[model samples]
Target: MLRARRWSTRLFNLQRQGRMGTTAPIDGEEAAVVGSAAAMDPAVDWAVPQYREPVGLSRFGDRVLLHTILYHLGHPDAGAYPPDIHVFPTQISIAAQIPHAVGLAWGLRLRGEPGAVLCYFGDGATSEGDFYEAANLAGVVRAPVILLCVNNSWAISTPVRLQTAAGSIADKAAAAGIPGVRVDGNDVVAVREATAAARRRALAGEGPTLIEAVTYRMGPHTTADDPTRYVPPEELAAWAERDPIARLGTRLEQAGLWDDDRQRAAEEDADRRFDAAFDAAQATPLRDDVFIDTAYASPTPQLERQRRLLHDERSRGAG
Candidate 1:
């Protein structure tokens, strides 16, 4: 979770300095991300992500949290992973990956696969039709999928109250006839336990689970956003009291798992990694096929033509 904070901070700053592509800030939501991922076996489970889930996806093929930066920087193949990596490119549209999770889970069951699928989305997504559809389908088919909703209390500039009428986002799961759990999003252990319980139920053929991780987002939706305009300073300060990493660190410290020396070492190790990743990302040759390569598979007929045209243009420029 500390590493995720460092990555998000750097990525957010990179956007401000025009050194990287756009990114969503995950400053205060580290526990929600890490805790949920701690429960799933990435090798067997399919991990699907919406745009802001790079932190959660870290358990799988987040690739040191640099591939997400690479993809945002318009690098082709940055989103690709090995079969066992079981992760796909990040979806930009809100709640877009919800149905994909349902589909993948159902497909896995049909094939007698051994794992469940875990999908992460924001509370704002609960307002979308796809969210309901996916939940309904998973419930009806008994698909082994866990819908992990990070209810950070804000969707871009909009508040959760404006997004839903329910008492809590977890209540939405009641309609789908599945178990819905609302946990302390800032509590790493609670989040992990809730997700693990959900995974167990899914694997036992009890159908889907909806986890409403009640948390807060302490930064802007993106670097381009000005939270000060919509988010009051008092609100930010209030959430600061519940910083997830600090809460977790306190627990670990009590358990004798963390210390000042260990934290210093971890930060130093993180710095070295970021330095290496910066060099690697910059070393890749910019090519005409970069955007085309971002495609998940063989380019469609139209995309192939586009790639050819780009190649020819680059060739002409070189000539």
Candidate 2:
């Protein structure tokens, strides 16, 4: 938890300093991420995470890759690594990765592989059509996928209460003929147990499971957002009482698993690592034509004209 807090602070600071393009701070959702990822076997599991899942991605040994991506959001790729090196590129569009996760799980199952795909998303994504379609397809195909919904109570400025009339996001899984569990997202132990159970069910061929981790997003949706405009100060203070990192740190300390010294060391380590990664990312060469292939193969006439103009300018400069 302390580690997560430190990284969150660093990431937020990077965003503020214009080092990172945009980032969703996970200050209050660390427990949900750490707990869920802690239950998985990294070698046999795949995690498809959204932008807000920093803690989850870190647990999967992608810390360096994460720092690299966070440092330069516009980089063409994640430093020549595989998708799951740390976490997959964070999905900006809502619920678009759901079907991809389900398809991967289905493929693995067909190959008789004993692995599960844990796809993380926010409560807002539940309202998207792909959410239902993916869940239904996973159920029908008995895909080894775990739909982990970090219901952080708000999607940008919209509260979960206003986003859905459903009693809970977990309840939606029942319609897909899969077991659904709602766990306290602030409680690391509860999240760990719930994730473990879900993985077990998937391995047993019981089909996919939906886990709705009811938590809060303590920070603004992003550096660009002014959450104060929508969220009341009192509510923010209330959520602060349930801060996931603090609560878990307290628990670990009580159990003789953590201490102030260890906490300090972890913070220092994270800071050092972040500094090194920031330097490395800044030192990396930037391709002059990196944005040239961002669009489809058949460029629009306007784009072609712009390309020709750039070429002409380069040729004249060479002359």
Per-residue error for 25 in candidate 2, Å, reads: 0.6
For residues 1-319, could you state the per-residue lDDT of candidate 1 as single tens digits?
A: 8878887777778778999888888888888988898899987987788877775466875463666767767777566655667876788888889999999999999999989998999999999999999999999999999999999999999999999889999999999988889999999999999999999999999999999998999989987788888998998899999999988888899999999999999988766776777677777667756667556476788998888888799889999
In order, candidate lDDTs are: 0.86, 0.81
Residue 195 of model 2 has an lDDT of 96
Instruction: Give per-candidate clash totals.
Output: 0, 1
**Model 2, C-alpha of 254: deviation from truth (Å):** 2.1
> Each model's TM-score?
0.93, 0.89
